[model samples]
Target: MDFYLLLWLCPLYIVGTIVYRLFLHPLSGFPGPKLAAVTHLYEFYFNLVQDGMFIWEVERMHAQYGPVVRITPHELHIKDAHFYDEIYAPASRKREKYSGFVAHFGTPSSMVTTIQHEHHRLRRAPLNSFFSKRSVVQLEPVIRENIGKLADRLAAEIQKDEGVIRLDAAFTALTMDVITHYSYGKSYRYLDEPDFKLAWKDAVLAASANGAMLRHFPAMLAVSKSMPHWLLKKLDPQAAVLLEIQHMVRSQSVESLQRLQAKKEDNEKTNTAKTTNNDANDNNDDEQAKSIFDALNNPSMLPPEERTLDRLQDEGQILLAAGSETTAKTLAVISLHLLRSPAVLARLREELISVMPTPISTASWVELEALPYLTAIINEGLRLSYGVTTRLPRVAPTEDLQYKEWIIPRGTPVSETSYFVQMDPTIFPNPDSFDPDRWIQAAARGERLDRFIVSFTKGSRQCLGINLAYAELYLTVAHIFRRFELELFETDVDDVRLVRDRFFGAPRDGSKGVRAIVRGETLL
Candidate 1:
C-alpha cells in the first residue's frame, strides 16, 4: 500500500514541476522542445549519450523555432547572425562564462574556465604577453625548427612505407612537441617516437573527455580529482592518465622552483651587493629557461592566491593541451580539403613557387604569412575547420541583453558558434567546398568575411594562443607544401568528415589519419 502511494505521489510531483515550467517560468514564452523546458535530461541524452549532439540539436531547434530558443530551463541560445557582434562585443561586461558550460575541464580555477569577468581578466593578464604578435615573431625559429623536424620524420616514413605516411599522427606529434617545448622549455618530443606513436596524445584527449564528462555529472569532477590513481585504473584507466599528468606537472613545478631558488642563493653568495644581480642576470640569461613556468611563477603583479604550484600545474596542463590540440585539428582540416581538391592545391603550390622561386631554401615566417594565396588558404582552412565546433555561453549577470525586438533579462545565458556562422549559406555560397578563392574573392570585393570567421572567437576573452597558433599554422603549412608533394594514400572525405564535436570538431572514424605520399624533396 505504501509503495503504491509513493508511485502516485512521484508522478504528481513531476507533472506539477512540468506545468509550472511551461506556464509560470521566466523563460516559458521562449520557444524550445517541451522536454527541454521540463528538465535537463533532454539535453543530457544528446550531449552525453549521443556524444555532443546537443550543439547540433540547437541548430535544429533554431531551424524549427526561429533564432532564439530555450536550450535549457535556465539558459537561452540565440542563433541570429546580426546579434553576434552585440553579444561578443569588446566592451560588453557580459563576458562572464557560463558555469554550466565550462564545468567540463573540471578547471574552474583556469583562465579558460573562470566565470567572473574581473577575475578572468586578472588571471589572463599574465598570459597575454606570451602570445603577442611580437612574441610569436621572436619565437619563429623555434616553431620553424619543430616543423622541419616533422618534415624529416615524414621523409623518413615515406622512404620506409612506400611514401605513405599518416599525416594526422605526424601533425599531432609536431604540435604536441612544439607547444610543450614552448610552454615548459622542454618537450616530450612525440615527433621523435618511432612511427610517431604519441601515447601522450591519447592522454590529452582523455583529459578533454573527462572535462566534458564533468559538465553533465559535476560531482564526478570531485571524485575524479580526488580518487587514487591505482584505484582509478581498476575501473577507468583513461581517467587515471589525467591524474598522472597533474602529478607530473606538480613534480616539474617543484623542480623549477628549486632551480630558481638555487640561482638566487648562488648570486647572493657570490656578491655582497644585491644591486648588481638584476643587471648581471639581465645581461647573462644563460640560466634563463624561458617557459610558461618562468613567466607565470615570476609575475610580480599577480595575486598571491593565483601563484601556487597547483595553480601553475593546472594552468600548464591546460595551456599545453589547448595550444596543441586545436592547432593540430585545424591543420588536419587544411590537409583534408587540400587533398580532395587538386586544383586548389596546384594554385597554392604555384603561388608558393612564384614567391620563393628558388626551391624554398629559406623563408621568413612573416614573409610566408604575407603571400596572398597562402594567406587565402590559411583563412579558408580556419573558416572551414571552425576552431571549436560548439558555442561558448556568455552570461550578462548585471544587465539585460537587447537583440532588436527582444530584451533578454539579466543573468540569461547567450551563445553563438562558428559552425553555424562559418557555414551560413547566405554568407558563404557553397559552404561545404574548400575554395581558397572565396577568401581571395571576398578580399577583392571588399566583403567583411573576416568577421564571419570566429575561429578564435572575439572580444577580450578570445584565445590567448591566437598568435602562437597562427605562427604554427603559417609555418607548418608553408613548410610542408613547399618541401613535399603529397597525394592521398587510401584516404577519403569520409575519414575526415565531421563525426564528433568532442574536445573540438573531430574527423570521422576509420580515418587512419591524413595518409599521403611524399613525391618532392625538402626545399627549406
Candidate 2:
C-alpha cells in the first residue's frame, strides 16, 4: 500500500514542478511579481477592482524588467518605443487581438475586428475613402456647422444664467450630433432636438456598463457565447444589453439607407433636368458633391463581393460607436483640465483670439489649424487623459519572435498598455500634471513626438477617424473658447475622477460632471 501511494505522489509532484518551471520559474529571471506569471487572473482582478492602478502596476514592472515582462503564462507586456516599430511594422509578423477585448457582436468581422493581415487589408479597402484626407476636407463644413450649433446652444444657456453653463451635457450632445451626422448624414438629428429619449439613454448607459463587466469577466462572456441565445438572454442582463445595442444600430442603419436612397433619387432628377437643357457641362460642376455616404455607397470603389449594403451599414455603425463616445469623453477631460488650470485656459483663449477676431461668424479651417496653442492643448489632454487605458492586445503571427532575451512563442497575446507609455516620467516630467506646454516645447525643439504619442494606436490599424477627430476638436474647442470663458462651478478640479469602463475611462461618482460657468457671452 505504501509503495503504490508513493508511485502516484511522484508523478503528481513532477507535474506540479513542470507547471511551475514552464510559467513562474523561468519568468522569475524577468521581473514581475511571481503571482503575475503563475496566473493572470490576479492581475485582471486588480485591474477590475483597483481603480486605475493597473497602469501603475505595468509601469513598475517595466521599470524593473527593462522592456519586456511576462504578465501571464501566454502574455507579454512590452514598453520600449523601439519595440513599437517591431510590433506594428508591416514587415514584421502580425498577431491576433486578445479575445477578451474584441467587439464580437454576432456580425461578421469588420476592419477593426479582422486579425489576419489579408482580411484586414480587404476590410480596410472599402472604408479607406471615408477616412481619406480629401474625404475629411469635404466633411469639414458639416463638422463646422455642428460645432457652430453647439456653440450657439451653449451661448443660449450662458445667456439664461448670466454667462455660466454646465458643459458636461453640452459636450456630450455636441459629439453625439457630430458623429451621428458623419455616420448617417443629417437626416437623424439626435442632438438638435433637446429631448433625448430616456429609454434610449438608459440603453446606452446599460450597454456601456455591461461592456465593462464583460471585459473584466471573459469567462462569463465565453460561457454565454456557448449557451443558446434565448437562454443566454434570460440568464444574463448583459447579453440583453448587447442585443439591444445591436438592434438600435441596425434600426438606425436601415433608416440611414432609406435616406441615402432618397438623396440619390433627388440628385438623378437634377442631373436629368440639366441634360435636357444641354447645360450638362456647366451643371456637372453644380452636381451635389459625393459625401462620405456616397463614397461608402460606390461599388467600384470597394472590392468585388464586399460592397453589400449590410456590410456598409455595419461599417457605419462601427464608425459611429468608435467616434462618438471616445470624442465626447476626450472633450470632457480637456474641459475639466482647462477649467482647473485657469492660466492654461487663459493662454489658450489668447491664442484663439489672435487667430479669430470678435463677431466671428465663420473661421476658415486653415485659420483654426494654424493655432499652435490650441493644437498643443488638445494633444496634451489626450496624452494625460489617455482615456482608453486598456491594453490593445495583438497576437503573434508566427512562433519564435525574439523580444529581448526571451523568445515569445506564436499564439501568445502581446500588448503594451498606453497608460504606462503616457505616464513615463522620463518622457513627460511630472506625468500626472496637466501641462500643455510640454507639447509646445517638444514641437518647438522639433524632437520626435511620435515616440511619446499613442493616443491613437500606431501603424496600419491606427484610428481611421484621426483627421476627422482633429478637425472636430480644433473647430469645437476654438469656437467655444472664442465666445465663452469656462469656469468650474460645482466640482473641484482636483475632485475629478475617472469612472472606469471596459474600453475607456469616464467620469465617476456622479461628479456633477464638469460644470463650467461661461464668461464673456458675446464674442464682439
Candidate 3:
C-alpha cells in the first residue's frame, strides 16, 4: 500500500509541474513550442542527444513563432539582429549573467564567468589597461616572434612530398604559444612540436564538446575536475588532458604567488638601507608584472579572496582557452577561403606585396590593418567564423527589457547569438558565399558593415582579449599570405562550415579541418 501510494504521488507531482510551467509560468505568455515550456528535456534531446543541433531548432522556433521565443522553460531567446545592443547592454545598464547558462564552462571565478555585473566590473578593472590596444601594440614583438616561428614550420613542410598540414592545429599551436608566453612570461611552445601538439587542441575542443550536455548537470564539471587521473582517463582521454591543463595552471599560480611573496620580503628587508634601492626595486617589480599572472597576483591589483589559488587557476584556464582557440579558428577560416578563391587570394597578395615587397618582408599590424582588401577579407572571415556559436544569455537585474510589444520581466534570462546575426539572410545577401567584395562595396557606399560583426560581442562584458585577437588575426593573415603560397589540399567548404555549436563553433564530425599544401615561397 505504501509503495503504490509513493509511485502515484511521483507521477502526480510531475504532471502538476508540467501543467504549471505551460500555463502558470510568467514566460508562458511568450511564444515557443509547448513541449519546450513543459520541460528542459526538449532542449536536451536536440543539443545533447543530437550533438549541438539546438541552434537550428532555435532558428526553426523563430520562423514559426516571432523573434522572441522562450528557449528553455526559464529563458528567452531573441533572433532580431537589431535588438542585440539592448540585450547585451552598455555599462550603465546593469546586466548579470545567468548562472545556469554560465555553468557550461564551469569557470565561476573568472571574470568571463562572474555572475554579477558589478563584480565582473570590479575584477575586470585592473586588467583593462593591460589588454588595451596600445598595450597589445606594445606586445607586437611577442606576436611577430611566434608568427616567424609558424612561418618556419610551414617552410619546413615545403620539403616533404605530402607537404599537407592541418591549418587548424597549426594555427592553434601558434596562438597557444603567444598566449602562454603573455600569461606566464613563458610559452608552452606548441609550435615547436612536430605535430603541433594536436592532443592539446583536442583537449580544448573536448571541453567545448561537453558544454551542451554539461549545462543540465554542471556538477559533472566539478566531478571531472576532481577525479583521479586513472579514473578520468578511463572516462575520457581528453578529460585527462583537461586535468593536465588544470594541474599545470595550478602549479603556475602557486609559483607566481611564491615569487610575489619573496619579492615583497626582499623589498621590506632592503627598504631601510637606501632610497635609491627602493626606486630600483619598484622598477624591477614593474618588469615582473609583465606576466599577467604577476599582475593578477599583485595585492594592488586584486583583493586577497579574489586572488586565491583556485580562482587564479580558473582565470588562467579561461585566458588560455579564449585567447588561443577563437583566434586560431578564425585564422583557419580566413586561410581556407583565401586558398579556395584564387582571384581573392591574388588581389590580397597584390595589396600585401605593395607593403611587404619581398616574401620575407615584414609589416606592422597598423600598416596591415590599413589595407582595404586585407581588412575586407578579415571582416568576411569574422562573419563566417561567427565567434562563439553558443547563445550568451544576459539578465536585466534592475529593470524590465522591452522587445516590441512584450515586456520581459526584470531578472529574466535573455540571449542572442552572433551566428544568427552575422548570417541573417535579410542583412547579408548570399550569407553562405565567401565573397570579400560585399564588404568592399558596402564600404564604398558608406555603409557600416562592421557594426554587424559582433564576433567579440559588445558592451561591458565584451571579450577582454579582443585587441589581442585582432592583433593576432592581422599579423598572422598578413604574414602567411605575404610569405607563403598555399593550396587547398583535399579540403572544401564543408571543412570550415559550422555544423555544431559548442562554446566555440565546430565543423562536422569526422571533418579533417582546413588543410593546405605549402607550395614554395611567395615571389612578387
Candidate 4:
C-alpha cells in the first residue's frame, strides 16, 4: 500500500510540473526552449548581470527551431521578414506599445509608448510635422550648424594635441548639443559649457538601464518603489538619473514654449512697426531665419486644432530621444570601423576628395542620397552596430494572427529580432565582417534593400527619425572623413563590446572610443 501511494505521487508531481508550465506560466503556449518557458530568471540573469548577451542564446535556439522560437512563454522571437509583414501589416489590428514599461513622469503617452491606437494616432499627428521631409530639410541647417561646431571643437582639440584626441566623450557632447538645440531651439547650450552636467547625463544613463528591467519585470516596479526612499536611491542610481532627465526635459520644454511665445510677440511687434513705419521692413527681413517655433506657429502651416502645447512637447521629447544617441553611436561605430580598415578609410577619403574638395559647404538631400560610397559606409555601420536591437514587440489586437502554419493567439507579444535577422549569414555573406561592398553590389542589382534592413525598422511603426538619422550620418561622416583621418590606437575589431540597454545598444568599456590622429601627424 505504501509503495502504491509513492508511485501515484511521482506521476502526480511530473504531471503537475507540465500543467504549471502550460497553463499557469505567463508565456505558456508559445513555442520556446523548455527552460525559457520554465522561468525568466535566466533571461534576467543574462540581461542585467551578464550585460545582455542573451540574444545570442536566443539565436542558438532559433537555429534549432527554424524562424520562430519562443524566448518567453508570452513572447515569440521571430526572424523571418514575412513575420515582419504579419506584425506591422496595415490591416493587422495591433495596439500601441505594451504596458511592461511605464513612463517616467505624468500619465502622458508619447508616440513610442502609447498603447491605445487612437491615443497614438492623436499623439503622432502634430508630431509628424517635425519629422516630415520638408521639415527635416528645413532643419538641416540646425544639424549642419551643430556638426560644424563639433568639427571646430574637435579640430581645436586636435590642434592642442597635435591632431590626436579621444572622440567618445567628444561625440557624446556633440550629439547632446545637437539634440538640445533642435529640441529647445538654441535656448540651452551644453556645447560651450566647460563642465558637463552630471545630473543630466546620469539621469539619461540611469533611466535607460532601468527602463529595460522595468519592461521585462513590470511587477517588480512597485516593489522597487516600496523600498526606503534613500535605500532605493542608493540601490538604483539610474532611477534618479531617469527622473532628472524627464524633469530637465519637461522644464526645458516649458521654457522653450515660453521663449517661442515671447518670440512670436516680438515678431508681431516688429511686423506692426513695419506696417506702420514702412522703413522697418529691411530690419524685419534681416532678422535671422524663422525658428522651429515660427514654422509650427504659422497659422497657415497647420490647422488651428492641431497646435497644442501638449502635442508639441510630446513630439519634441520623441525627436530629442530618437535623434540623439542613434546618430552619435552610428558616427562612433563608423569612425571605429574606418580607423580599423585602412583600405576602406583610404577609399572613403578618395571618394570625399573627388566629390567635394573644400569639405562640401552644402549638399542637397538628393545629392547626398546619390553618393554610393557614402550610403554603403553608413549602411554597413548601421548593419554592424545597430543602435537598437531586441524585438520591437507588438500585440495582436485581433483574436488571432495566422502566419504560415501557426495561429498566434491574440495579446501574445509578437516581435522580430532585428539583430538576428540582420546577422543572417545567408542574407549577408560573412555577416560579421564589416564590408560595404555587399551593400554596393546589392544596390547595383536593384534588389530592394529595405526588405531585410532592420536598422530603421519598417511599416507604420518604423523609425520616424529615419531620414533625419540618415541626413545627420551622411553629413557628419562626409564632413569628418573629408577633414580628418580617424585612427584606432591599441584596439582591434573584437575589442569593441556591445553595451546593451533595454531599447538600444552602445559600445561597452568605451571600446570604440579612440584617438583621432590627423593625417599629416600620423604614418599609416
TM-score of each: 0.91, 0.80, 0.95, 0.80
Question: What TM-score, to 2 decimals, does candidate 2 have?
Answer: 0.80
Q: Encode model 3's per-residue lDDT on 99-140: one tens digit a residue.
A: 888778756678887999879988887778879999999999
Residue 348 alpha-carbon offset, candidate 3, angstroms:
0.6
Off by over 4 Å in 4: 1-29, 90-95, 101-108, 162-164, 193-203, 216-232, 260-318, 359-362, 495-502, 506-514, 519-524
Q: Tens digits of per-residue lDDT for model 1 on 242-317?
A: 7777777778778878877787688666554546556654544344437767767664647678988778887877
TM-score sort, best first: 3, 1, 4, 2
Off by over 4 Å in 2: 1-31, 38-40, 47-66, 90-96, 99-108, 162-166, 193-209, 212-239, 257-298, 301-314, 359-361, 396-404, 494-501, 522-524
Candidate 4 residue pairs in backbone clash: 27-73, 27-74, 203-241, 206-238
Clashing pairs in 1: 104-211
| Residue-wise C-alpha lDDT for candidate 4, range 323-351, written one tens digit per residue | 66666667777888888888987788677
Model 4 scores worst on lDDT over the 10 consecutive residues at: 100-109
The Cα error of candidate 3 at residue 163, in Å, is 1.8
Tens-digit lDDT string for candidate 2 (434-495)? 88888889888997664767777776677888777777777777777667756677766433
Looking at model 1, which ten-residue stretch has the lowest summed lDDT? 280-289
